[model samples]
Target: MLLTAPDETQVIAREPWIPRRAAVCLLICFCLTWFYTLGARTLVPSDEGRYAEIAREMAATGDFLTPHLNGIKYFGKPPLQAWATALVFSVFGLGEWQARLWTGLCGLAGIAMVYLAGSRLYGKGTGVTAALVLGSSFFWAGAAHVASYDMGLSAMLTCALCAMLIAQRPAASPRARRNWMLGYWAAMALAVLTKGLAGVVLPGMVLVLYTLVSRDWRTWRRLHIAPGLALFLAIAAPWFVLVSLANPEFPAFFFIREHVGRFTSDVHSREAPWHYFLPLLIVGITPWFGVLAQSLRHGVRVRAAGFDPGRFLVVWAVAIFVFFSLSNAKLPAYILPMFPALALLVARYLDSASPRATIVAAAPVALLGAAALVVLWFAPAWIDNAPASTPVRRGQVYWITGAAVLLALGGAAAAWLARRARTWALTVLAAAGFLAGQALMLGHESLGRDKAGVAYLAAIRSEITPQTPIYAVGQYEYALPFYLGRTLTMVHRAEDAMLLDLERRPHLWIARLDTFVATWEAQRARGIKAIAFVRPDIHADLQRRGVPMRVIGQDARRVIVTNDVTAQRP
Candidate 1:
């Protein structure tokens, strides 16, 4: 019996028996791959530490509804992720792993959703393959372990889409369909809470397009829109109402600015060309890029009579992909919401695509290893111009070299196994590739440690006293507040939603650079202690102005300074 990628006929013909233990084993492997060295790296700035600090503030103030940063109103995002992190922090006592555990859990749940959806729509083989494809994808795995709202939003969207697809099936019983509809509503509501309006808008667009393209308007009747809408409102509305009532500025900042403005304008200065996510998707999928391309190509074909799941999945994936592409704001992780559908579609294709195609697909991944080898050998030359403390570690090079070798070996093994055992080949290749990629990410943590401010914070921890007012002048480091166990008073740098907070509470924020300098001088004259975080350029400028600043600590990112009187006293 010649083993080849299944065709449409072969897809229906093949009954690859996937044992119950396969799911259990997959879950175990997922935990290992996703959570490995999760806490080994310090919390990265401006996102991970920002979210963690918000959660810490929530826990400290005992306020779950209104999210605050630096003791001021922060209405940039809703409080779902902050709430979850606060809960984790409460029980786990506020650590890196605790902060990111929610995201990691969401990532795992997303992989599970794809598995179940694939199993129900195609077969167990397709289901398992889809799970592996998504669970091991470079972007998915990497995003999962970070402390961000994207993972939570992606997970909820996956649940809503997968549950909706399952509910629309002709084989679904009345009760089963109703339950699935309810689940879909709940998922969308949670998604709304996770990331403002994109949660509902993107899914709504996909559903509308799918209805028109597949000519399946009758599917709407089964959606139970009245109850579904009620459920969605029930879960998603109270937070908006409460937050708005509590902070009168919430409505304008959240809906108009965060949702509409963020999508249409380059409000955050995150502008990119339409093709930004193209290379991201290719690199994101990594070893599975070959199979994914074939699967997506096959996804357009019409199949099944009542509700075409293939077309629907394709629509779901493509709609979101194009939605972000058309948006003015572009980030690599913005396309994360589309990955689940892509995984299912890829699983469908791998069920019947050619064995030769699978082998050919593994070629790029093998080459990726060779590239890593080059990077490993040239690490020193590459980072020569970096900061004095930014030297590449031998361990990082070793890890990269090992990952490259592992990916190459996995690709080689898959190529050989594709001739006789395609399923085994894919599974082995996925596990090896995912583990190798994870190792590389873990290894790279050291490169950013200096800039992340863990060491600098430790160096200055004892110098800070309860009465000493610490100011973050000109810049903010997200990790600093969390590590210091308090917030920094902002001076001359209030951007994003922080700008709105500054408006609400002027006293908490210093708007003028000159005002901060005068205050520092006055405090030093009175024999009061004061400290500030300034950028290197700002430090140089202050020196030129003869401000008599004493640099207690410095790094590539920021310089920690004190008034000369404070330095002399302590």
Candidate 2:
């Protein structure tokens, strides 16, 4: 088999063996990198545990319309993510992988969508490269396995964008066009369910901006607005109507408060500088930073002829990037939707890039990875931001150090490949770095072991009777309720975890500390078995107030106590 010149196609059509081998390798790498590590770590709190528990509670209670957290109504976001997780739980039974199955699957689907989109817009080689970039990108892969709504949102948004692009193809048949348009509508509706109004708003904004720039006013006529809208409303509206009807306050809370207020004000206190996502995007793209930047730069150039998918991709990436940048609240994952478009653009750039240009681009990633390796191996002390009193284990430290070494070698190999003008080296290096980075992240789970409370919950599992009363007093470890297999009585505080749900269903929460103390004392006097999870500070205060409790488990952040009993080692 003779090597063909690297051209627009990049693939050697005369010798099909090359592409078949490449495809086989890509599939194997995808499986190992994406799916194998889904259950490597305990679910981390705030988001992972919260979403997983919501799904668990939804499955346990059989209330799909109203999302619940710790037995209270939770409306922070829409039900799509929870609904999907619940469905997974129903099938697989509750566990870490089961909770994350939907998200991981969606992430894989998003990669496939980008591959198809890139193949249609560019060539087979470009399509394969696009899939590699997306599946290997650190941020995308990180969000892919986490039990969060953002992955779902990103997948649906990609579907809508890719479907719209297919629908608008000049050579497509009428029936094909209609089906693609329907896909676009269905994806948009699912996106709305996954997140909030941003599902519809972000895609609509992107399309409108693309039309304005491309001067494709006729494209609007191709949407078939009547039936398209009907399809959208049919898929997206029934849930809103049912949820709102079931909980009247949901309308104001979900739309006005969650959507309008969250965007316009600092309601969630997730304030960040205007350029918050800039660094995140940089770090998220990881070793491919140079390629991604060049792609965006090349993508924005006005095409003289043809369909100009690059221009549309540019609009998609830039519009979404700017939209969240201008919003009052921002998070790292907020810009995930832009990545698929960016990957396609980068694939196009790589497909046509010169050897010198490729080397120049790969240099920075090598340097960056080298710097990170130095920080991890030589300056391990710099990474220890945890409390000085916290015990550091030599074994775990060495494990992290090993992961860093793997990353450094990956960087070095990538640089070597770049110098040799190996186009596929970027994918290989990225896969190595991402796989190592994931291991590093998974290893960090040791740091949060106490906070995650998986071990603590195991110790207390037998102590908890069917009717044992549990209280989260003055603190909440998001993983506790899920691990304990029961909802906690939120004692004396109903803020972040409870939110507006507290107002609607305050019975699940004791709003006054004094009332909670009195009830606890009475329960103790009556010889009722009860357990409470409280912060260390709160535990000391309770101890000072002569709260009769025996410590059953202790950690850096929390102390689990039982009301007046001979606490066995747990």
Candidate 3:
């Protein structure tokens, strides 16, 4: 498409592709990246189970008044995300694949929205490039599959910022303000529902900072404060008010303990110093990390020559970083919302960029992609053992570190090759996407293979017959019950409920590395027919104790033990 500025002025920016190609690339990117995740077993540990459990409770109890964690009242977050997960579970049933549906869907929506927002703000190519980079981000992919609150938060925040950007345009009409303002409030309110006040707090702060830095305090006038406030309260307030009324402690738990308390103190997982967000931005940006730096520096150089690009890009980017840094609570994922700004900035830099800069950016991304292939090829070996002391597992981490190092080197090479050209921005984003995709395709096995709760539960369903008892020792993998479609009791001690549960029922499956030996005597004494486990340490020790726990069936990793004696202990 061709375009001219207002009054037939110079065409400041152009997108090379027609609308059709842009949409297709984005759609293809979206489908390929997360299409795998939707089908994959829940890669996350507790988050999937915790959220899925809450949804199950919501559907089962029919009382959405309070959030429940492990069957207890859990007020850690607002109900928006839980409600969405519940809707999916309601339709699809409570499995990780079904429960995580919203995350993947929202992730794709966010990718599309990025292109829309970027294309409008800059040009088509820049918009596509921004989406490409952000889509492949480390957090983006994981968040899509993890069934967590972060991805929704990212979507909400992006929509809010993009809406606000449209609202701030000089030539913005009342219609634009109303449309975008409504979107802003709606997204903010949903964000509030998803994760809590930070949805409103962070973006609000960023906008205020942007206004201050942009020397456009007057911009707030079009914010349409009256309607904005009404919309936010209308969307967000009802849930808060209702939930608070239903549970009086909701106010303290949701607002104070979670938001205020979490920020001032290390409430959940007290992380490191202000430097916490540094690696996060790096990892969260991934493959594109090098490209973004170039974008920032190049964008800055262009603006220093009396252009507004630096002010807009730098202030927006730094403001987000500073906002999170000042907050005491920090997680790598918390910085996700800041990416759209980086994307937009990168797009702008590329739009005005020389061809050389574009090529340099692509080289690093290509290198990062190739590096991910290396990780995938070796990820199986890496997942074989604990990272405690094994040389192979240690080398696996080295692989990740090495991939990262090469990615950086490639960026330097791109900068050297392209010099100060705009094409650098174009090259890097595609490369980042390619590498990120490689990891997604080949590295899925490496994530939770050794302790794969889904596979374990599946085996229990298929192999064990007639109310077989399943006990997870050493640690409770919460995902077990969700995948198994059962309520699992925890074995506080080896001799605790697991022993008793097995006694009450026949053919029990116990999973523990430390106390497998003791189970053999108990198995024989009780006339237990079989012992099923992931290791043979227990079998070895039991044999040494003169108790024969023969392994009937064994896989590459685990062994199954069965005593020849049948019936209960007499």
The worst-scoring run of ten residues by lDDT in candidate 2 lies at 1-10
* Per-residue lDDT of candidate 3, residues 407-447 (tens digit): 54555555554554334434544444544444443344444
Best by the lDDT measure: 1
After superposition, candidate 2 runs with Cα above 4 Å error = 1-19, 302-306, 380-403, 418-423, 566-570
lDDT of 1 by residue, 1-570 (tens): 322323222245453544569847876766775675577677887788889999999999999988988787888888899998898889989788888888988998999999888887777788888998898788888888889899899999999999998888776899999999899999999999999888899889989999999798998899899999999999999989988898888898888998889999999999999999999998788778877766776787646677878888999989989999999999889999888998888878777667786687676777777777776677867566655554456657677788889888888888888768787777877877788878877887876566577777755676678778899888887888887878889988865788887876799989888898899899888887777889888888888888867777887689988885444534
**Residue 244, model 3, lDDT:** 74
lDDT ranking from best candidate downward:
1, 2, 3
How many backbone overlaps does candidate 3 show? 18
lDDT of 3: 0.62
lDDT of 3 at 4: 20
Between candidates 1 and 3, the one scoring higher on lDDT is 1
Instruction: Show model 3 residue runs off by greater than 4 Å.
Output: 1-15, 18-26, 29-33, 297-313, 366-435, 438-442, 462-476, 489-570
lDDT of 2 by residue, 362-459 (tens): 67666775676676564456445555633444435665666556656766676677645455566666676577667666766676565587778766
